[model samples]
Target: MRTIHTTSEEETCEAGKIIAAELRVGDVVLIDGPLGAGKTAFVRGLAEGLGADPRNVSSPTFTILQQYRGSMPLYHADLYRLAPAEVADLGLEETGLDGILAVEWPDRWTARPTVAYLVVIDDQGGDDRRIRIRR
Candidate 1:
């Protein structure tokens, strides 16, 4: 497990970029955090580190899933609005088979990957955040 403290959104994103170096194709990252916890910022860094344009990354809360072209591929999903039963219909397992999958509000995902990186973000008031990552 690894823990990082960030006092700004940029720092949180940098942490994500640092962790991105350790990821590979077919990797699943489950991200859990409260509202406005900089989850999207972290994922923006992930996209940038994986060779994608960070400007193109955004929260998929309404769209559900967003795909980006990178060195491999980035399939970002936001399961906030879905019930656990609805998650399977998205075919996330298949979508993640060829790229790195990052899922926000992953508690709704019932078919979680057997092996995955779990990222938890805790808001510490103001712009401070504590991010914990583990496999």
Candidate 2:
């Protein structure tokens, strides 16, 4: 387990970049946070770190899953709206193969991935966040 503190969004995203640099294919990153807690911002840095176009990374609130190509392909999943069974229907196992997966709102699912990095965002005072990472 590891932890990081950030006073602003940029710092949070930068931290994500650092973490992203350590990622490999088949890596699963599960992000847990309340609304506006910088989950998406972290992923933006992750995309940038992976040599992907950061502009192409966006919240997949509607589509549920998005794919991006860079040094390695990235599979971004948002499970905020789906039920556990529905999430299973998407076949996470398949999507995670040959790519890196960054998932938001993974609470609905009961099963865990083979290797997953957990990011918990704790909101402190204004613009302050405590980001904890565990694998």
Candidate 3:
């Protein structure tokens, strides 16, 4: 486990980029944070690192999942609006068969992730986030 203090959103995104550089296909990144904690910003950095179109990545709160093709496929899932059981119904583990999965609000899902890069976002100060990355 590693804890990092990010003084700004750019630092938060840079942290995500570092993680993204280490990521390979079929990786599952679990992100937990409160509203406006830079979860989506982190995803944007992940998308950029994966060689995906960062501008295209957005909060998939309504859609549940969004797929992007890059060096490796990236499947972004948002469980914010779904219950645990409902999230299970989406078959995340199965979808993870092929591409790398970046999940926000992963606590809404009941199943244990086999290999998870857990990222916890903490509000340190105004526009600052303290992100802890645990393997």
lDDT of each: 0.90, 0.86, 0.85
RMSD of 1: 1.0
Q: How well does candidate 2 score on lDDT at residue 56? A: 86
Best by TM-score: 1
Ten-residue region with minimum lDDT total, candidate 1: 53-62
Model 1 TM-score (2 dp): 0.96
* Cα lDDT tens digits for candidate 3, 1-135: 888888877777778888999997778999999988989888888888888998888887469999888888888898988999899889998885676899999989889495788999988769878888988
Residues 13-125, model 1: lDDT tens digits: 89889988999889999999998898889999899889999998887647999998988899899898899989989989898778899999989988888589999999999
Question: Candidate 1, which segments miss by more than 4 Å at Cα?
Answer: none
The pairs that clash in candidate 1 are none
Best by lDDT: 1
Task: Kindly list the per-residue Cα lDDT of model 2 for residues 38-130, writing each as its tens digit.
Answer: 898888878888989988887875799988888999888888899999988988877868978898887876675746999998889799999
Best-to-worst ranking by TM-score: 1, 2, 3
Q: CA lDDT of 54 in candidate 1?
A: 91
